[model samples]
Target: MLVLTRRKHQSIMIGDDIEITIAAVEGDQVKLGINAPKHVEIHRKEVYLAIEEANREAVSDVARVDLKRIMGQLGGSE
Candidate 1:
């Protein structure tokens, strides 16, 4: 993990475009502002986890095919 200390109003640039800035600090919580191109997606860790989990469930449901349904669609004996 690349950890650095940044005070309010200071920023760190990433690569050629992305920038992360410290907006405010209150006790143990901090607010940050990110600047990036519209094509780039920035997601919080928990949000990503939830999206991944939902995708996994959908994929698994599709993978668990009903053999009977397939045979009926094919007009073949089960």
Candidate 2:
């Protein structure tokens, strides 16, 4: 992991697209301002993790379902 110290109003660039700026600092909390293209997705780490976990659970639930039995019940063409 790369660690860099930035003071308020300082900015960092990612590749040629994204920019992160320090907007404010108060006590131990720091506020950030981000600039990026609309196609780029940005999320807080915890929120991202939650989304990933939910996707995994959805996939697992689908895998556990008896699709063949449901198709038979619906009179699907075998």
**lDDT, candidates in the order shown:** 0.91, 0.93
Instruction: Please write out the lDDT profile of model 2 over residues 1-78, one tens digit for every residue.
Output: 999999999999999999999999999899999999999989999999999999999988887686756877789664
lDDT of 2 at 18: 95
Which ranges of candidate 2 are over 4 A from the true structure?
66-78
lDDT string, candidate 1, 1-78, tens digits: 999989999999999999999999999999999999999989999999999999999887876666556767789653
For each candidate, what TM-score against the reference? 0.81, 0.81
| Model 1 segments more than 4 A misplaced | 66-78
What are the clashing pairs of model 1?
A: none
State the displacement of the C-alpha of residue 19, model 1, in Å, after optimal TM-score superposition.
0.4
lDDT, residue 73, candidate 2: 71
